[model samples]
Target chain A: MSHQFYSIECIIPPHIQNNIAEKGTPEQRKKVMGSISQSAAIRAQRVLLTETKALVEPVTVGGKQRNIFNLNFGSNLPGILARSEGAPPTGDPAVDEAYEGAGATYDLYQQEYQRESIDGKGMRLDSTVHYMKGYDNAFWNGRQMVYGDGDEDLPEPQRIFNRFTIALDIIGHELTHGVTQFEAGLVYRDQSGALNESFSDVFGSLVKQRQRNQTAAEADWIIGEGLLSPNINGIGIRSMKAPGTAYNDPLLGKDPQPAHMSDYKTIDYDNGGVHINSGIPNHAFYATAMEMGGYAWQKAGQIWYVTLRDRLTSTSVFADAAQQTYLVAGNLFGGGSLEQQAVRAGWQAVGIQIDAGDSGGNGGGTGGDTGSGGGTTSPGCSTALVQLLDNVKALIENRSR
Target chain B: MKISYRRTGGFAGMLISHSFDTDTLPKTDAEELVKLVSAADFFALPSKITATGADQFQYTLTVETAEQQHTLEVGETSAPENLRPLLEKLRLLARGKPDL
Candidate 1:
């Protein structure tokens, strides 16, 4: 198995696609199936991308540079440049939304976390709208953002999916995947993969919250707020406040997310339930934000940002993330403070016990397998085994020295 | 003789299945399917596909003839190129979509 270098992060999960294929009309089925194939083909392209070294110059403008493209129902990427920085809106909903959403995300990272951009180096934000004919999904293809216009051929009741660019949080969610790629570089598989997904959701919520200036209490923690069609029995794709309750429809099926570690899925599919089990950490973040009482991005988001940017390695597990955030929260806001306590409680809410006293040996230390690997976290050898081996190796090397 | 195919798992996690009885199918299509199945050596295909990530569809083909019945499973990304036409036809039939 080769090292899994990149990931295709989509707003709609696979289970939802499967549900549509089974229950949707013949036209809907064709659209959904085509989306599945398109996404698969993009994943295949991602593998090829890793093989080549593409040079991307860091943007050093006033802040961020946003470039929007229109696929015009075609497959080619970054198709036609619809808008760019300092340009007026083209009166197109998708283009305007993508531009504003990218700007909002940049502002959140810029003003809150002081992140230059998704890469912390002012990387130009590139997006493509109307990716394909009757496409049902939007995704970050480990490179640029792509959105679909949503299926228009289905009947009103069967029209359960809206345009991909309809939701601001969904845009934030997709862009955060790019942030994860640059920072944690979380291998998109297994527990670490879930962490990759959870981080994206966490920050995605933050971007939306900061944009609306909504507090944790005031904000609706739904990830894809307006992305779902009105005819569906669902509110959104995934709800951070209530994981499994996000959607329950005859066509979409029930949301399969588990908010606690005990209920975590251990399936071989979906890269070990990367998108499904993310509910655990997502709830943890939501809890932490609620406990902090105010804007979530202020304290809770900061801790997670610091953890993602500095503390987490590519192979860090849920426990490692929980522990690292606990340590970082204390460091950011004095030990035993309300912020620190909230961080500790957050992990505990998700069945991950992070000892308050455990400062994690060395602060911000690279634990276990550092960069991307074969996308699999070894069985039974989790954060504990990683720490143990590190200690053993340290002892042997010190003795020889 | 009966030929059945089912496709499950994708971004939406949908399952679509259809069966074609040799006696019920058009003579030309049935002959083509048999030739395709035999020439493609459906039985030799792998049982399960290793998915690279999310949104992958899994295809299961079941063929029953006078001698025996056989089942073959392949993933969307891992399936051999030879099986494309057969899988495409099966998906269309399963969804009640026009194959022509």
Candidate 2:
């Protein structure tokens, strides 16, 4: 057994060992650990050699690796590998589109946000296209992307949708759901679900904008642009800039998204209106980006990304999103800076008021214009300290109540 | 026997519905529908089956017989294996309808 353990180190490559460490069963992982410990000096030398090689050669580590599959109009996932990373186009529109879409989505997160991939650990992106005949939807499925061909089987005059992979933002949107799953794990119901949907739309639109080199003002802010069929009286599935106006066709009914909290729909279906109410926060993001007046990804996108990655929880509501984005903007820029003010105005435009108490104690208050910049006077207290004091005060108030 | 199905909350956020009475169909089709419903043990299913994921479809299915009627709401991920064939049949039937 001791000889076998030493032999294991010689046989298995370091990359395979890393993979086993991450995904192997507990017993297997323990065995791998023992082998690693027994061969520390050899492993160190190997690591140094690998690092030296990497320094001299171009590295693909933490880079995008996409796998596109053809479902062949079947329901089974990843039915057949149509394209792999760095592969040439297959001439099949669905396969090629899925391939390109995944790459573009990967680029958005990797280039703009410094996120390695959907899981923030260079997880390989897998997408299956042509899922089920005339299937009119796409989804993240908690693991990989699944896209339907839409009403392609229907007669041209009656078709209501194009292929699910037609829109780059839709691909970005579904991929961002994977990001949200790895991050906040927002429950797929009620307000948290709406926030989940909103985050997808926010990042999805940003992906398209960055790819197009569009400024905040130049971008259309549509979630599923060009996805609807030509006969349909719709530009897209939903509009972040103008939520309820995305579509209004006799066949598809109307887009029911509301732009403000005052108009929030309390419906029984659609998971407490997750898709519907997402418009509020979507518009809020649009407003924030518009106010910031540059590439939306620069400030507005960073604030939302940090908030989603750090501050928001599974059960966070609209108010929590507003508050956290404001705090994150303040933290990233400066307290009461233009970016923070833009976030505040964005949420305010959507009828969600960030609690003044939360921002008052941001502590890095460079702007003396804010009336409640009391935390700025206390230079000894850090922002975290001020936040702690606020939490304590809130706890006392809740207890008394 | 009467059956109705509504699907909501996909990535596109579109709503689709289809309803039909077995009596209106040919005898063979009606019998097949009855067989599918019976095979699914529709009445035995819980009123709601919950699932967690983003942008998956939610289905509302109602079946009516001479004596009783039952409605079940299920998410796509949580939909039981037995229930899927019936859902698939209904989804195919719903295609090409004006409201789809």
Candidate 3:
């Protein structure tokens, strides 16, 4: 909790936002800028809040606790309480969708990974819908998720984005950011940053696939499906099976994700291509899952979860992640087993080589040998979020002064 | 004085840029922009902003004044409050330039 953890995983990348700003009509440009400004403002506020000691304590809540908030087109965090856990659907599409999406994500981590909630300690899941006027993005702003209406006010054909909460994978994707905050705490820049993004995409897709009961072969492997407005000439934002093939619209441009390290982008934009280069490891996970030939969440997801929770450090790069997952796989499925081989193949496909000698407890240099169990029980999380709610209230009060 | 702003990074890996000489802008607006830029103290800002993994925009601003030339890379969220108007003006002026 003492370590500052803040990241915003926007469903729409900033390049797309910049493109829309340039290519869209006056109104569309305003909407996209609104989204960008909102994001910037939230980040600025988050940096200030995280520096305060009062906001960094963690609180444990038993079972699934979700709170869906209604922003009503105003810029506010955790807006009016629309619904709480076990509440009846209010017939409000945004509220209901947010509620249901959070539930499904919670179920996935709890049922599949045996973790309680995003923090593995039953941390409360909070979301805000209808954030700001004409906002066009959804993001996990460190503490909670906030979604926009996706330019709904515009007429058909002109609208470029659907409601942020419409796609369940988007919800799963944002929530996984929270889990990453609690777990690996990966430094959100360069290669480490991409791994953080890939983990979210990997689990986000699994949440959608598992909900549909689709096998690895049956899954589409696309993140943010149904997120773009109908007029856009793209299926989704990013494709896992095929990284750069997701979208190619006149305004949004082509997806620039690289499936291999050779094509990795090293620029400082998008936090060293966190969203772009994630395609490398994302493809790795898909390949590993397909090779195993069953439910991806079963073995593939388990290997990733263990690697992320127990092995990864804040500075882990792609090679570090590959090594940890390979070692974790050997422990979970036995050394030289098919599952372990699949893990090796996954990293190799991404042009990252896992040293065969660095097997079973030899990797993840910060930790000790994980032994034959392969799975290490993640340690209990410290205080960070529960104290945030209290600190935010104080901040709001101070702002009014 | 000539000023240029280049924006890079984001989801799509695209770059957008625009530049204008102070001699071209309206006298009053140019004066306001010069004052704003001076107030922002761009040279004093940190080299990198916070390390959050959002699809943030990075702006490289180049100023060619009679005295000297200076360039700095700034995260979108890290720009000082006094510099907001200048950044917005640059982006507004950059509109309609065909994407490169």
Candidate 4:
């Protein structure tokens, strides 16, 4: 049989894009130049290897999902082993990872939420494994997911045993992108994008916690805990339980996620660093899990999942998501259920409160302007928030008027 | 000379910069094809076949993350015309902005 294959690269890694985007000095520009140089050398070498490989025929009768090419995970560049139907990973570590990851995601959706494939229409799952030479990341594009073998400086082979590279949680985290895409399609910009990322982390962590038989209290609630490459900075890429504490590395700097709304970063990049500012809702979920004191999947995951599916808008923002989840929690478990209360407390912990109007509390948008009950974290917002509040007020008034 | 194609900078995933080190005719042809297809991502001047080492003409392409500004290098011992399909894939990836 012949094989058809394709390669996908990761989101901008720590070095090139982050550096160039953040800095404006000559020295920083030099570093960008150097990265460009190194990239050129690697690409040249990569082209040579792929050139010699013969075209691989597809094993499946129908084309591989959306296209006619088959993508199999392997060490060979541009190696196409088989198509998307029942394509078990064939002893290739990368393939195995992709296969297993897909399985876990599929299982999670079916078992937990009863959702269909990425599009809720049994869309054939497609993935490319062993994507690039020493590439150090994995990400889901709009259509499919791609994995990198990682670089020598990072984790070689990018392999994880119990925790390192092979963590099922991370797999779930990446795959949730598909779920988000199909559902809320949260715009990846400003607060909305951050909310989108938060939803992914919340659900991603729950998928792992539920699978591993860990209670919400017991789970670490970190996105890529053990998968952090040995030489990199920080413990993982992100932490739901503790936002900014994920890492403190020299080269990669630190995990910059702020857990509270007051500290929210309004700067718009990486679609508002959806991954970075996601820490806010992540913390909200963590707090909800803590207050609920049970398996997170039972209450917390269900709440986020349902809201993600039903309540949240495609362009939902952090506050919008928070408000929607609060309403959903009440609907799922009743207004006075512990689930709803925990939802309120959770959002409050992140310096977000269900509007008195939304909650049917004291009304007049009054009572407590109080942000948090008792948490070390504070919202990252500022006097600018007042302006935002004014804008929101005008919006409400305009709509009402 | 051996050659391959590497791609990088799309979504929130791995960075790809692939190549095969070799001195072969088909390999060189693959590189040439890729260059021809990737007109949008190239610099000025036609790719010159320079014998950098051995009897191989190095065809180089640099792709930076459109959103992240990360750069990845992909090249081959062949000319760019031989690597059309691979180059097309990279072009598609760099075209749109990823949500996260």
* Top-scoring candidate (lDDT): 2
Cα-based RMSD of candidate 4: 17.4
- What DockQ do the predictions score, one after another? 0.06, 0.43, 0.11, 0.05
Question: Candidate 4 lDDT, tens digit per residue, A1-401?
Answer: 00000000111111222212233476775465334333333333323322222112122232223211223323233347443446544665556666666666667776778766665555566666665443345555555555654443233543221222355666676567767766655655666667766776776777678778899878988777665566555566688888988776554456678989889875533444666678898999999989999898887888889877755544556666776677566555644466777988999999997752333111112221111222311132233234434554664575577
For residue A257, give model 1's deviation from the true position in Å: 1.0
Quality class of the docking in candidate 2, CAPRI style: acceptable
Give residue A374's lDDT in candidate 4 (0 to 100).
20
Name the lDDT value of residue A349 in candidate 2.
Answer: 95
Where does candidate 2 clash, by residue pair? none
Runs in model 1 deviating more than 4 A are A1-62, A359-401, B1-100
Q: lDDT of all the models against the reference? A: 0.69, 0.77, 0.72, 0.53
Write candidate 1's Cα lDDT for A30-146 as tens digits.
576444433333333332342232235334354789999998876656699999998998999999999999998888889888988766667789989987655556667666677
Lowest-sum lDDT 10-residue window in model 2 chain A? A7-16
The TM-score each candidate achieves on chain A is: 0.76, 0.77, 0.77, 0.67
* DockQ-based class of model 4: incorrect
Fnat for candidate 4 (0 to 1): 0.03
RMSD of each: 13.7, 14.3, 14.2, 17.4
Q: lDDT tens digits, residues A24-132, model 3?
A: 6778765764454333333335445433412363445779998999988765466899999999999999899899999999999998889998776677898899976
Which pairs of residues have clashing backbones in candidate 1?
A: A14-B11, A15-B12, A16-B12, A17-B11, A17-B12, A17-B13, A18-B12, A18-B13, A18-B14, A19-B12
Tell me what TM-score chain A of model 2 achieves.
0.77
Off by over 4 Å in 2: A1-62, A357-365, A368-401, B26-32, B38-44, B67-69, B96-100
**Residue A297, candidate 1: C-alpha displacement in angstroms:** 0.7
TM-score of structure candidate 1: 0.68
